[model samples]
Target: MRFAWKVFLSGILVTVIALSLTAYWLTQAAFGTALSQEKQKALDRMRMLSVVVESMAAEYSFSSEEAELAGVMRSAATGDFSSAALFSKDRRALYGRAGESAPMEELFEGAAAGLCHVILARDGGYDMHMLMPVQLGVATGYLYLAADVSAPFALSDEMTRTASLITCAAAVAAGAALVVVARLLTAPVRALSAVARAFSKGDYAGRAEVRCADEIGELTRDFNAMADSLEGHMRELAQQARRREDFVASFAHELKTPLTSIIGYADTLRSRALDEEERFRSANYIFTEGRRLERLSLKLLELMVLDRRDFPLRDILTGDVRERLTDALEAVLRGKYGVTLACALPEAAVRSEADLLQTMLVNLIDNAAKASKEGQTVTLTGRCCPAGYRMDVADEGAGIPEKELSRVREAFYMVDKSRSRARDGAGLGLALCDAIAGVIGTELHIESEQGRGTTVWFLLPYGEGEADAQ
Candidate 1:
């Protein structure tokens, strides 16, 4: 059954049993005690009457004189005794309430039971009964007496009624008390059960409201903690899913760009109409595009491996930050754009992941070089932070807008989509840098004010103890 109903029924059943036993015991006890008191009173009266009769017999018997026996009967009529009678030893009634016969027949049939009480009548209605036998000796006549048992009978009946009333009231009180106790005890458990159901249905935010310092409250606290952990895990899973989708889409596009160029030039070379010069030009185009395709594939593979855990860290190398910055800037500035590469960096060797570090620098510097006016400096700055190191690649020309800075590192999130396409980017460059920075426990920060300039940089934590906030 439901919990509340079970508690209520149990309370009721217990109360009923308790009251029933109490009523039965009290009823029996009151009746028994009343009967005993009455019987004792009757016996006392019989004893007194017997004493008077014996004394009279001793003084007047066999003297040829008639004795007044009425005084003896009258003398036995005290408040404690009812009808007192004189009986011969042979079971003859001498006197009593005018034809009151004592049941000496019972004494002959069984033991006297020693002044026992029976149900009897004062005036023939059988209100209650008590009788006692008295004998001067084994040969003398006996005196018989019964108490006026009406009062005890009435009182016993009243006591039975009172006990019954009390039992009923007690039953009702016990039932109410038990019900209240059960509800108070089980409230926290019920609330916890409800919250468990809610949590089973996937509401990780569900909580039991049990607040006391007991088992139920401890269970509630544990449930809330589990939910908090589950929610955090779910959020992490969602974020990973988004990152995966972005990675796949961007990687596919990057691969397709070089593939399309290589295939187009190769097909041109295959056409039979092309002469030596034309074929040479086509083959050169194919060759260049093939190299670009090779680079794109290698970069994609490196990034994919880095994204997964269990990829071994390639050794930590100590290197001068300034030297690395110079090499990366020189490599990007080789184009006829005449973009000047400027480096401002610390001379000291810093711990770095060489391949990842070089690539990160190349991508930022290349992008800066692409956006710069010829003869303008694409300034590269390397500095040390409390955490390991920092590098900035900033360009003055055609600066990225402030609003798009945050999303710039996002895969394929080009602010100038058409211009980015002409620059022959696989669009995975910044995304690669961002991922590498994350793998090495660093952050890539970007800042731009519209029409001013854009600066892309990385912050490398100094040690494992360095604080990182995402």
Candidate 2:
């Protein structure tokens, strides 16, 4: 059954039962009081009739014969009594007729002792019979009186009918009220259920309104909280999916360019007889494209490894980190790129995964070198700050445009695509640095002005072993 119906029926059932019992008890009590009063009235009238009969019998000098006593009773009997009878002291009927079903022997025995009355039920009504022994001019006689006392019983029946009608009316009214109450009480639950259904159909914005400060309202709040969390997680997952899609597309395009060049140059060298200069040019092109492809594959592999693994950090002197980064990049930057390398180191220790930190620093400095002119300097600097040890790679290269800075960390995103391709840059350097920074529990911050230069920096929190570091 629906909850509303269950509530309504239960309320009605309780109302009917309670009201019925109360009505029955009240009617029965009233009927009992009325019947008692009626019985008393009947007995009082019977006593008065007995006294009148005694007075008449004495005044008329009545005999023990049935006809004489019957006349006396007929004259004396006036109110309430339907019939009167005279019985001899020996228990024989002497005057009026008595009921054959009446307890005559018992009535006679009671009268011989004292005045007595009994109410008897007969034919859907009641009769009160009274008997008493009287002295009739030295002759003992018994007077029997019967009064119809069914009025009180009829009144009781009427009261019962009225009570039943009242009980039924109360039940109906209560049922109507209960239905409204049930619906009001369950309104929040119904709203919550509707919201849940909508949410199941992918409507994450749906939420149940809290109507009151009750348990049901608390339930609605909890459900809304859960929905909010689910929606946020779903949005994050979708963003991750989009990033993956973009990464795959970019990766494929990068591979295609390098592989196409390598294949074209190799096919040219293989398929035709060429001059030494042309042959050397094709071979060199092939080798450069092959090297670019190799670098792209290695960077992709490193990115994947970073995603799949967790790196543990340990204390390393900031000076040592600077030396390692400078050593790793100085030869390539100064010799190959003709870029001057400079380092400004501080005496401090930072928490970092050594290999990952070095990899990230190398990428930053290499990018700095690539962006700089032959005589320009790429400077690596370290400073101890309250928050952490800050490291920066500042380059006097052509700075990135403000519009392209936001996307520079995306894989294969290059500010100057032609310039980058000419320098064999696959545009994965900053992307790889960003990933490494994340693994080290930090993030890369880049600052650049269009014509000035670019500065890439990160911070590593001070480590516990700072005092012992060189």
TM-scores for the candidates: 0.58, 0.57
Task: Report the lDDT tens digits of candidate 2 across residue range 1-470.
Answer: 87778888888999999998998899889899999998888788878887887877774443534576777777775555548888777767767767655777778777767987778889978888788988675578788888888988998899999999999889889988998999998888889999999999989999999999989889999999999999999988876776565456545544543454466667778899999999997787667546645665555454553243465679888778776555445655666678988999787878887766765776787778878888999998988776778898999988998889889998878888887777667788788678668877998999998779999988888789663442
| TM-score attained by model 2 | 0.57
The parts of candidate 2 lying over 4 Å away from their true place are 51-67, 99-125, 132-142, 236-247, 265-470
Which segments of candidate 1 are over 4 A away from where they belong? 2-35, 57-107, 111-116, 119-144, 150-184, 205-210, 221-250, 269-404, 407-433, 440-445, 449-470
How many residue pairs clash in each candidate at the backbone level?
4, 0
lDDT of 1 by residue, 1-470 (tens): 87777888887887778777877787778777877787666566566666666665554432232234445556655554445555554656556632244344664333244554445455633433334444332244445555555766677678778877877787788878877877887898888888778878877677777568887678878877877888799877876776666556545655543455456557666766788898887677667556645664555465563345323344332244455445334533654357888777754344456555665676777777667677788887766676556778899878877677777777767878777777765566788778767766678888776677778877654433232421
Candidate 1, number of clashes: 4
Q: Which RMSD does model 1 reach against the true structure?
A: 8.7
Clashes of 2: 0
Q: Which structure among the candidates has the greatest lDDT?
A: 2
Quantify how close model 2 is to the true structure by its C-alpha RMSD in Å: 9.2
Per-residue lDDT, model 2, residue 240, is 71
